[model samples]
Target: MRRIFILIIGIAVLYSCRNKQTESNNIVKAIAQDTLSKTVAGTADVGDVSPKNDETVKLIQKQLKVLLKNDLKSMTNEDRYFYYEAFDLNNDKKDEYFVGFSNSYFCGSGGCSGYILNHDGSVINSFSVTDFPILVTTDSSEKFYNLLMKSGGLFHLVKMKNGKYPSNPSIEEKWKGEVPKESTKVLDIYEKKLEKYSF
Candidate 1:
């Protein structure tokens, strides 16, 4: 009788563990599905340009299309378009350029990938905001930036340092300040830009 009782207890424990494992897996799968369901969609309008140079607009459009085509070629079933804008972020006499892409792979809950192209045709920055990105603009220094509104009730601002993309800060000491709660977002931007530039 005691042997039978021990066997029953062992079976119960095994089934309990199995159920817990299945539940955990289900939760993980649900999160992954939710993330994949997010899509990024938006319009990028260019404000009036001084001197009204159509040549500059043409150049920006051509370069942006080429860059985006090359960058996203390997990804599967990609349907996206580049939205190019020219704005004077620093109030400098010269206008800076902004290029963003709409991603369909991850939709609905707001997961998308994009890059910021400098006026020189060099990519200065990039980002993937999981939440709905409300705004993407440069600061006074012409540093690329993004504002994300998360589903979980949080707001984040991701800023990339000037001339700092395409390469990581080699010195560990540079991370000295209190780590930004948005470190992951910052890091993702850096890494994406680096990957794009490295090729």
Candidate 2:
């Protein structure tokens, strides 16, 4: 009788331990599944945007807003407001625009970077630069410029030119350590576009 009681107690303990281990594993699996589901659902929402010619600009702006909202969740409203700037690039007689957002405090750090839509609300092209870019106006031409601190003291100055689609990019200029070199022809092209749009 004593031997039988000891054997029963041992079996009960072993069963309890095995059940607890299985429960813990199930909890971990549930958490992983939930995370994966959320990620897939978020991506699907972005993909649903219609890429029609007429709707492209609106869609791009909407996407930018969604991305910024998600990425800058930790920022206060005022801080978030200072992070983005939008403007038209080309003189296509349409209101093409560029939108830029900074992820770091001030404008130059690890963060988000992109271009805005033209009047047609379509994205022309976009490239990423380290740090937050500031919109600078020099003698009437406006551009998106940023400094890459991680690089060997190089500055990237990007200008959007107004012209037909699929043509050579209007202009993409890079300057190092100082003000960009000014070219009369480049200025003239910008001025021409500005004048055409100003009226």
Candidate 3:
């Protein structure tokens, strides 16, 4: 009879522990959801830019995990933070992703790093020594919009050549020309806002 009592107690304890774990998991999920909601607040339903879209968000996060697999191992908690904005760079009415990392590990004296991803999260281009507020100009190359990225305190015109932007902006010529009319600045403070995301 004592053995049976001990068995029941063991089962009960295990069940209690599982319930507590489940509750903890739920709390974590709740916190994540709350953060996501705040991150996407005041954003319009234009495209997959909304973090409320769980599937798209999950897919983007998964791709980032794979893309930054090596860097992830050495990244500190601060380096795990990222920000992104979606814009139709190709003018297909579909948004391509512009993800930026601003932490010390990703930044240097020249500038930081950013990734331009296609609609499906495939990397279209990865640029080093790049500064934010990526400008989408009215100019076109290979049927895609040209970009003006700041590096070394000067704007570099990043025209799509052979289907990719220059991997390093520090070597590109400075943008001496005027930003075309109707051009938009993405990830800027006033317009084309960025959404903070934790990896």
Candidate 4:
């Protein structure tokens, strides 16, 4: 009786151990899937945006990586990274992507080792910032609106001209929330589209 009792307890311990291992493996798999989704859709950030399709998401990432690797090869910031967003700057229903890089050069938040790409994956323009634009969006005429900090820490509005933002933007107001002055409907639509694609 004693020997039988010991065997039963041993079997229970082994089964419990196996269940724990399986649970651990499942957790790892879930984490990996979440990471892949974030990388593919670029929607891990509530403040950012990206392509609404899987193919476009992968392509945008590849294009941005190539541009940063081959084009900016001379740079030497080990921590340098890129964040991209796909939006229709021209309201053409086609997507344009912006690749922003991390570097010490940006004195403020909106700065990028800057590259804005067209639908064809071609660069439209690139520029760095002293006080990076806190808000970047477009107008009905497709003009880019950049809200940035200027002298005396005042917030200001700068419009893009021919794919280039002005180096010296006039003060508009103090920095507000991240929301742009663009229509709320567009933001809402994009967020919904993002959810549909991600799931």
Question: Which should have the higher TM-score, number 1 or number 2?
Answer: 1
Q: What lDDT tens digits, residue by residue, belong to model 2 across residues 72-185?
A: 666665445321223323334454444444334323433344454556445665544433233333333333222121112344444434522211111234454654332111
Give residue 81's lDDT in candidate 2 (0 to 100).
Answer: 36
lDDT-sorted candidate list, best first: 3, 4, 1, 2
lDDT of 2 at 14: 99
Return the TM-score for candidate 4, rounded to 2 decimals. Answer: 0.44
Instruction: Residues 22-132, candidate 4: write the lDDT tens digits.
Output: 999999999778866864553344233333556665665676667556545564454344445566656577776655444453335543345567887777765454233
lDDT of 3 by residue, 76-164 (tens): 88888777777777769888878787779988998888788898889998999987777787678999988888898889888888989
lDDT of each: 0.44, 0.40, 0.77, 0.51
Tens digits of per-residue lDDT for model 1 on 83-167?
4445544444565554444456433344445555566666665545433233333332234333332323344433445553322
Best by TM-score: 3
TM of each candidate vs. truth:
0.40, 0.33, 0.69, 0.44
Question: Which candidate order results from sorting by TM-score in descending order?
Answer: 3, 4, 1, 2
lDDT of 2 at 177: 61
Identify the superior model by lDDT, candidate 3 or candidate 4.
3
User: What's model 3's lDDT at 189?
Assistant: 29
Candidate 2 C-alpha error for residue 68, in Å: 8.4
Off by over 4 Å in 2: 1-61, 65-86, 104-111, 134-153, 157-174, 180-199
Better of 1 and 3 by TM-score: 3
